[model samples]
Target: MCGIVGAVAQRNIVPVLIEGLRRLEYRGYDSCGVAVLAGGEPHRARSVARVADLDEQVRETHLEGVTGIAHTRWATHGAPVTNNAHPIFSRNALALVHNGIIENYESLRETLRGKGYEFVSQTDTEVIAHLIHSLYRGDLFAAVREAVQQLHGAYAIAVEHKDQPNTVVGARQGSPLVVGLGEGENFLASDALALAGSTERFIFLEEGDVCELTLERVRVADRDGNDVQREVRTVAAYGGAVELGPYRHFMQKEIFEQPRAISDTIPQADSFDASLFGDAAAKAFGEIDNLLILACGTSYYSGLTAKYWLESIAKIPTQVEIASEYRYRDSVPNPKSLVVVISQSGETADTLAALKHAQSLGHKHTLSVCNVGTSAMVRLTELSFLTHAGREIGVASTKAFTTQLVALFVLAATLGKLRGHVDASLEADYVRQLRHLPAALNSVLALEPQIIAWSEDFSRKENALFLGRGLHYPIALEGALKLKEISYIHAEAYPAGELKHGPLALVTEAMPVVTVAPNDALLEKLKSNMQEVRARGGELYVFADSDTRIVSEEGLHVIRMPEHYGLLSPILHVVPLQLLAYHTACSRGTDVDKPRNLAKSVTVE
Candidate 1:
């Protein structure tokens, strides 16, 4: 995934483009570049390290322009290098910045080479500018359209022509693109955050949509060159609301903010109105007899958790499908079945396509639980539940997963009430407990200091094991995922009972095994599992309820949790793992926030 920004305006566009790229840096930060059409020629500056380096170069070079496009690349097609960076230029120096993959780039490059077009870079993005240069007649829009049609696979492209210095043309197929409306100016970005400071109103581009933007106006067109009308929605810049308060990283801030997000998701206690489901959602769910959840990564884990809640609490048969595998399967959906798509950024290409596939199978009921409001998946779905986790900058999801759980729990409760499986008193009790989750989360966050101490053991170890059972098995998997994602430590999670079966053989004196031993029905079983690790000469770091007293043996390092919390203990137990991962990564000199070869959003399939 990469970030793309373009602006056509009367004012100096360099500063605006740079600011926009700064906001969009979380999308991709491997390499950054900016191309400005100034003095009837494209002037480009780029860096292979960070956006700040590119900003420094921009200031030093004094490349002024009224129109420009910028990019922060994540290095998919080639290595991260100045030559392989984005804002790729044509032979005549017209610049283009692109996001997503060009599946047919190798074939396209061969064709361009036969035409005597010498290439300067190894990026798939470079092929587009050369193709445009070869095919350019007069109309930049026509050239861009023809070039896009020839290209295969996902892309969101922003092109600036040396001939048309005041205009910026953009097109999107599978990647995200947005047009920000401003007075005598227009902004183009892959996300709304890029244009937050510039304008509030934006028009989201759909698949096969193209637009040409000028200082005064913007025009939209379809693939066949027909003028198309689009709905422009106002985007409120709530950037300040996402502040981390006293936390170190957004991941830590969000890890502690889960309770608040949960509370906000379930505002009412007494009301079990079907109207909260929205009209389309209510009608869809009412018509469906079964439900299928499709997602990937952390969202898929959440979907797994939701399957348990839906079947047991809501009394509905449910299935969870991974998006990548679902597409290739012959498994079909019926008209009476519903498809629930879960994605933090509704722009996940596989999940979006899976939603479409479900719809094509005559499944009319499609609902999405997404954090991003303007993402393509949200637009494609019939109904959406927007999570209030704010901007999760970290690649590994912390708050989003918990918030999705809260939303799914509430939805299940609502469905149970609708089916007469639950009563008002029971629903009210769950809602009240949810309201108290924020403060409980704060108490859990207080364990970070202990977690930091526990991380010292991890810093010296090469491998670790995380163990949990029942509903928390998925949470343990998530905890292991967080550690491996940030710390680059080889970690595995298993059901505590399964430790003796196979994973225990990996336990040695050098291994540190972290057990999620919350004071619940499975506490004794988990404690026995910890004993097995200790007997095998394995060091232990246990996160348990303060009330659940266990003998601190020679190899046992026990972290006393706040208290015995029901259903919410998994949420509490995960905080320490996140802290452990962060501290361990810091000690190992690894990039905690931006792990190697991973982007915050996987926009391409």
Candidate 2:
């Protein structure tokens, strides 16, 4: 949940390292720091704030060096303070920056303390600096290798030694690391985006691989310190990483881009031409009698939504299972059954393991819907659908979820057409409507200012209820998730018809009920449900189609959407809810991007 970047060059590279850190800031960070080796001395500057603050600090301090390692930290073992910031230094001032949790650091810290090692900070990362210093045998690479050998748990580490001024050492185990190759320089970062501007050529470091980088070359080795062969892959860089561009946050940019992503998936709807899903997947799905979906978090919700689409549209018997729970369950899948896994990162450990488990059970027809191209999940699956959501930075997912839904919807529709359940005209109409989603999404985005005004009431309320019927019930659930994830609000969603059975008891005058009253077959029933909430003295906020003349009376607030887009209305309706959540969280002084106790990618189960 932290960002790490390093650079080794023939000329001063502090500026490049700082720029890289700024690029990676969207990953979420509490503190920022950089350690540069110049004239055989390490100069480190760190601060507890945004990367800008650290950049200002570094500028004020004038830390110039040709070799450096930087980190933007999301605190794990220590509080967010200057002392706890990364680029944690050894006793002699050689600095180390690390990503991932060092699970055995407490024991290791105690061991080091017993040996009279003085620690200046309370971070698990600081232990590595001390360990390297203590075990220094003149070779920075050897020292880092030895220190890493003594360490335990997941890490992507970048270290710079004061005595060894011309080199930087990087190692990875269970965490991501990449080496960017440039003329007369080399860059190291936890992600390719961090090195976007510097170079497109990258050597993706695999698990247990370590590299020693100098201005001229990068040498790779295994955990056992033996020489290892490596392949360099070229990455496509987009200028989007450098600027937000017409959007306030990356979340907003991504949200507005959903229509395009959906459109892209729709055109290739029935054509599974991607090599990731081969003949095996086509054959298996052609003969399969059942389908199983395994996923977690928002991906799991996407699967749940797909279960509805698949069952109704394709007449397929489907089951959606949370990946974390799927492993231990005594559930079984036959060779004639297809297992579909959905994940944004596809590096999510539990989901990846679940895919492996399903494969081991002889379920040969495995498919994955993932965003990352080279992720382990994509590599392991027999077939994969790559979501074109681009980069989703916010911990609370917005665009990725919607894109996953689009992919699933298209998949279901494709299956229906293939099975002769849908006609050519129906397919053409679906594609036409899907193409118009972008413009419809733009219409929804225009409602943000109005939604923000309504957020004033939500900011004061402790509890909220989101209600929808049928397809929109899932949309309501997703809306509630956004509110709770970022705003820290006590929010729940229920099918509007189910209110009488239970959940209505929680309704009171102080409570706010947000209803997704889209003009559909269930519009009248949803209006009745709203009336039920009003009878309980609950204040209401309704997102309705312009034609659904829900009267604006006492204790009621209605924001009429421009038009009714039918089945695609859920995609548009969710925009106002996302805005409500974002504004509420902003007003409450909560972290909208990186909510407390949450990580962007669930790499661990």
Candidate 3:
């Protein structure tokens, strides 16, 4: 739910901590702070502004040290203000930043109240700082272990002590924390991406694991005080240079990055062997008679689209579930089913929990389609298909959705071929069609100008309805999600046939209706649905195929795509919707990339 970074380095670690928090800004925070242990005290600066503002505060205060911890707070227990900011001190001995909720903080606060301990801020995290300080016995590591034993909930914490300036202690129970290996420095962060620029070597902590970091070495141990050997693996740097070179916002840049992202996901889509999924892919795909997809947010809509592909193309019985809901519900477990989890950041809390749920239920076959290789999803799953959509920084998700669809499409075709549901000739034809996607995507991106113009009009409206049929229904859902997420517009999507059931009553002159029309068998039916909206005086914003004949009229508006793609049409159709949401958010003067109350990754449940 929050971002944390701690560094013990030879050179000044303040700049490194700032950069690490900068990379994690997409995690959605309300305030930021940094604390450095200097001259037997913590020199700290905090702000209720962006990280840049906090950096300026650090400079103004001259807070400099080689060992420190920094945090970007996503407010949970307290409001986003300076008093509630992190890097909170405890009896002038230690400062700590925490990432998760303490379920028993009220009782802990009451207990500490009688121990002659005074409280400063209304934060659950400050309890940990004081609790650890109360248990101090000369060793910071021992103090943190004792403090964590009394805690009752999930946490990923990094601690720094005034007396132990060269040492940092970290522990994780339910949230993610990693140790970065460097020549003369060691780092701790909630994600490896925070340390991507400085180091590739990392050690990922398991549940109930704790680590002590120093400038010379990193020591990892489990909860029982026994030393543990965690593997140190090298990872590729994530999201190289997240600079807005030409685009207006990160959302705009990510919207335009779809073509490249999709292309990178499947460079050899035409000739890609089934082995792209790793050595066990063929065996796993052959054994599974059913497929279950678990995901959340935009990844959930991608799962919905893949349901169409898996059933029709692969001829497999597929069921899609929202990860958060799926884990809580009691569902039948089919051992033969392949449990697939899709996430841009592999650390999504609900999806990872769902994967563990399926695993605990004895569903042997499992796979993960994820972007971050170091994520919990990849490490826990039996098989994996890694997407090359590096560092999707936008909170609303532009390129990640398209690239996930690309990965799922590849999975469908590969499974179809292995199951004899598709002939080799037809599969070759599908692959050829897939090859046309990148270029087809480029042609589709050219429609942005038209979408921008449409946004100028639609932005004034506060409500919108999206309509689609068959496989494109998921695209319509995603379209509405983008609109509501970025533009703060009340938007809903329904199957075209459901218009008469209820939603048609909401259509009016002030409400714009967006229709996704491809030249499929359901085109005529979708047109009829659009007519119903037009008859209600609802302004029609139709994203039509190049030759669908859905032209512009008085109450109707249209943006024609370059060409018609058959099964891959959803991938192309979504691009314009992303542009529409981005431009509309721009028109309304809303935050496009980092919208209100949304995080790039849901690392906590």
Candidate 4:
């Protein structure tokens, strides 16, 4: 997970590169650096600091140039420190920024060392810079093309040389790279969102394609040194960086933004139809006999929840797989099965790879519930449902998760209609609930005060367990993940009945047990599970519906859900868990927005 932005222009492009890095800050970085060919000398500065801090360093040092490259690195090969920061320079006036792993770096480094190349920093990326510099042959693009042939594993690299003052060369293998076309200027970045401010037109370089950028033009070439053509496309209108207007942190702001996000994502009650999944969805649903969902992180949890909706409502058998693990394992694929991928930013590396892997296996019927229309997953999938959750800046997803649930609910309901499982009144009831969802979300947001009061308990704990049954089981897992992600607390989730098997042994007075107590058929069983926790001297934090009359007493605490949402309860139930994690992280003084060791969009696997 890293961000790369480069520019070639008539004027100083340092500001543009810095702004692009700021926009990319949400991708999660441990350090940031910028390199510019100032006065025909590659001048650079790096810091194990935030982009904001990097900006101040650039300003204080006066680093600027007409052509430049910048990087925000999430470490994989070395410790995250100032010395290991990006824009790794070589003695031959070359500066390079890389996004993915160089798997054969150790052997390459040893070979380079034997060739009289001295290394300064311990990073897989540094080897690339040194190798490129050693192989320099007066042409930057040609030299990089030759250098990459000697490398192994994934990379999206942008290289600039002091001698080549007006150009930047970029190459991609497994990671993503794109070219931004502008008037009298050209650019390269890892994502379209990074270049949205300067250019609307983009050329997405295919895997193994190397491209050169200058002030007035961009040229594309294949790995074998032949000229190629890449089609330039316009990006859809999208919101830029969100301002922290009134909230203390982006996580908090996103938690409160849920009401508006949910309202915008769900279709209007009057517009409810089989066409909600786009024109091709109906055909795909009709043709498919089973479902396979691929996703990672929070999206994987959303897929888990969708499995329940698909099996119980649509009568379709569904299997959810973590996208990163799906392609590596041997599995059966059905040509008639719909392969669904869920991602907030459609550029998630593993999910996209899994989509391609499934396609290679002859599973061509594909769909995606993604937020960005311009993302690669949308382009690769047969059909897409774009959620209007807008720009989710926080690394720990809030609005995007709920919005994906809304999209999946629509997909499930549409399949139900096609399968003749829903009557007119039942369909109308679902539509009515969609119309009332905004109001319901607003009421759920009201429970924040009560959640914060309970968060005082969570803040003091070292470990926690989440329990849910049936559909809410995924919600419990998501809650545990959120807590661990943001608060650095040890947390786990299990089905309520699974306690007696193995997890109940870990419950103690020091451990807090969080239970999802929705008033459904499983409520009584969940209560018995809560009793088991209580018997182990474990404190209880129960999220329950209004009618579930379980009150607060000894060793138990209850946070009431304003209303029971029936089939759509998971979406509402997750809000309090989000609040619980946010407040607990705040109480622990952890970074809520950009959590440690985690990036927002994982562009590299």
Candidate 5:
């Protein structure tokens, strides 16, 4: 994944470019650079540090231009070195910034080398610059159009030539690129969030679409070079929403914002309605007998939790698959199956590809459960539920995951209503539980001080084991993922019953075993699993419901949950694990917002 922002304006564009890069840096921050055609000549600055460093370099060097392209790279093909940074130029006559991978770059490099084109950086992106350079006879748009036809992989590129000031050419193949419309200026970025305050109007570039931006107009063309018009959307800046108010980190803010996020995701209703998703959802739910959920990472874990809800509550047979692996394997196609794709950004490349893969296999009825309403996944699906978790900036998702669970639970309840599995009393009770979730989450937030105390021990830990059973198993998996992601702790999760099968051998005093002990049917069996871990001299840190009767002992420590929320227990139980991971990362002094080798959105496969 990488970030791209470009501008063709009447005034100096360096400040706008830098600010955009700062906003987009969460997308990628290995290296950053900006190149502008200043007075019909190329002026540039780059850094292998944070985007702030790049901003300082541009300011100190007085780099300003009427036209520019900037990038924050997340090193896919090359190392995060200064030379490999973006704004890759061709003889200083043309400058370009790109996001995504080039699959046929090696061959393209060899072909360009035969034509006297020299490569400077060890990046696949450099080949595109040289290729565009060779194609530039006079027209920048023509050259870009010709160059992208030869590119074999996903890319969203913005190019500016020295010969053409106040003109920028942008193209999108498999990555996201949007055009921001403004008076006397137009912008291009990998995400609309980058151009939030800069502009309120945007045109989401379609696949194989190329566009040229100037001070006055924006032109778009299809892959075949046919002129086309894309609908312009007015998007809110939400700039104030992302601000960290009195919080140490964005992760902490998002963790504490869970109550509001969950409340917004599930509106207060006496009974869940299928119309809440979309008009087509009621008919589609009645037509489908099975559910197939495709997602990646945290979204995938949410889908796994949803599988239990969908099967048990709705009585629908559900299957959860990792999006990246779904297409590669052969599987049965069910026409009656409702295919669901879960994502936060909704631009996740693998998940989008998997959705298409499922569509090709005849799974026609589809739904998207994601945070962003304007994302590719939501646009492609027949029905969508936008989790109103506004702008999750932290690399490790907090509010987004919980909100997705809330949406999925609502979806399950709606399907149950449609399938006649849920009576009026049961449906009303589900709504009551949903409405009470926010207050329940606030109570869970009170346990943060205790969770922070646990983090003191977790900071010294190198490895950890998390155990859960049934629906909570996925919560354990998500907790392990969060711990490993932000805290740099190697953590693994397994069903409590599966510990003796293979993971039991890993138990020791050095290994901190965390168990999600809800007072459900499996609590007694989970207690037995705890005994096995204690027998191996492993210290157990348990997050148990008050009714579970789990007591603190010499080798065992317990933090009781605020409630045992029945069907919604997973949502309540995961908050403390999130707090545990957050505080542990804080205690370890790791970069909680931008963890190394991770991006906020995986826009590239």
Candidate 6:
């Protein structure tokens, strides 16, 4: 949830460090800081404000140095205050910036305190600084290597020593860290997006790998202290997606960009092909008899939707698991199952861990649906489909979720064809629907003004309920998640039939009920569910198709969708929910782009 940038250069690197932190602001942070080895001493400036304010503080203080590290921290283990910010120093000898939590910090802090180390901040990261200082033996890299052996949790740290100017040492355990290759200088960052403005060549460090950066060279070492080599790859930069051009917030821009994102994710060919996922996808898909989809957050909801498609269309049994819990519980392993991991950033810690766990259980067929091609998930999987939702800056995902659905739908269609469930006519029909998805998304996005009107009522809501059936049930879950994530509302979702079980008791005049009323087989049952809500005096807001004759009355409100896209309606229904959440959060005056305590890429479990 935090961001880090380190630089070792001949020129003053303060501007570079600040720019990197600015690029990383999308990750969601509460504090920003910069530490520099200036004039044989460590100096730092930290603020519990925006990066712009931190930049102003640095500029006003005239902070300059040849080597430096900067951080934007999303609070964990302590409150978001200046005293708990990063760049925590140790006895004026070393400075460190960390990304993940340290599990054994309490015991380490006690040991350090016993060694006469005084703590100034309420942060686990401060203990790391003291530990490194206590282990210093004239080599910054050696001290960091020794100190990390005692640590017991995920961390990506960059450290600097006053005695060794123009040098930076970076270590990675479970969190992500990268080395940016420059002409005369080298750098370290948590993601390539942070260094996209400076250089494209990067070395993604492996787990337990450490690297030392200087003006002219970069040296890598493994966990056992032996010299190692990491592959260097070039990453393309995001051109205009990084800028907010005429939109009020990144979330709004992402909502409107869903049409383009979906179009780019799917091909307009006459038939779907498994090779689009990877070269070996066809063989792997042929060998798998069962499907296991794993993900977290919004991606997990997308997987839940895919389970319906794989089972009904592809004639394959499928199961979806939340990535955070998949590795913890004991479950039966099937060697013939295809393990699919979905993530927007590809670096989600629990999803990646789950993928590795499945592999450890002898699941050879693995695939990843992700947005970033250079992410750990894509690298670790046997096959991958990269969604072209470029640079999603919003903490709540919009375009990324839609594009992932497109990819999973394609996967479902390809498997159906291979399994003899989809004939030529069915394949052509699937292709036609996919090719028309962009236009369908455009028409759905056109209903924003009406959705905004509904949001006016929802903005006054303290609690809400969403109802959907079959494929749309997952969409309802996603809508509830989006509303609760951005608008600070307590929202819950249940299948339309499940309303009678227990959720119907929560219905009242004060509770707003949002229903996905597509004109499918479940429309009649959904209509009955709406009547149940109406009988309970619950106000109903329904996103219905043009032909689903659900008209608006006193307590019932209906917004007709442009069309009813069979099997593909979930993608269309989700756009309106996104708009509702976005406008509601706007009316509530909450930060739509950077929601509280949520990060764009969840790198820590």
lDDT of 5 by residue, 1-605 (tens): 58899998888888988888888866647999999887667988989999889988988989988899999998888899999999999988999999889999999999999999988899999999999999999999999999999999899999999988879999998899999999989999998988878899999999999999999999999999999999999988755436889999998999999999998888666778888878988888888989999999999999999999999999999999999999999999999999999999999999999999999999889999999888989999999999989877889999999999999999998898888899999988898889899999999999988999999999999999999999999999999999999999999999999999999999999999999999999999999999999999999999999888899999999999988999899999999999999999999999999998999899888
Please write out the lDDT profile of model 2 over residues 445-543, one tens digit for every residue: 888888889988899988899999987888888889889988999999999999999999988989899999888899899988988998999888999
Clashing pairs in 3: none
- Candidate 1 stretches with Cα past 4 Å from truth are 240-247, 546-549
After aligning candidate 3 to the native by TM-score, how far in Å is the CA of 297 from where it should be? 0.3
Could you tell me every candidate's TM-score relative to the true structure?
A: 0.96, 0.88, 0.97, 0.97, 0.98, 0.99
Worst lDDT 10-window in candidate 1: 238-247
C-alpha-based local distance difference test score of model 5: 0.92
lDDT score, candidate 5, position 59: 80
Candidate 2 stretches with Cα past 4 Å from truth are 132-136, 146-152, 223-226, 240-250, 268-281, 287-289, 324-339, 345-365, 374-376, 393-395, 497-502, 519-528, 545-550, 562-566, 585-605
What are the per-model numbers of colliding residue pairs? 0, 1, 0, 0, 0, 0
Residue 502 of candidate 6: its Cα lDDT? 97
Q: Least lDDT summed over 10 consecutive residues: which range in candidate 6? A: 235-244
Evaluated at residue 58, the lDDT of candidate 4 is 90
- State the lDDT of candidate 6 residue by residue for 386-472, as single tens digits: 999877889999999999999999999999999999999999999989989999999999999999999999999999999999999
The models' CA-based lDDT, in order, is 0.83, 0.83, 0.90, 0.90, 0.92, 0.93
- Over the stretch 312-427, how does candidate 3's per-residue lDDT look in tens digits? 98899999999999979899999999999999999888898899999999999999999888888898888999888867778999889998998998889888888777887888
Model 2: colliding residue pairs: 277-383
RMSD of each: 1.9, 3.3, 1.6, 1.6, 1.1, 1.1
Error of 3 at 570 (Å): 0.3
Q: Which stretches of candidate 6 lie over 4 Å from their true place?
A: none
Q: Which one wins on lDDT? A: 6
Winner on TM-score between 4 and 6 is 6
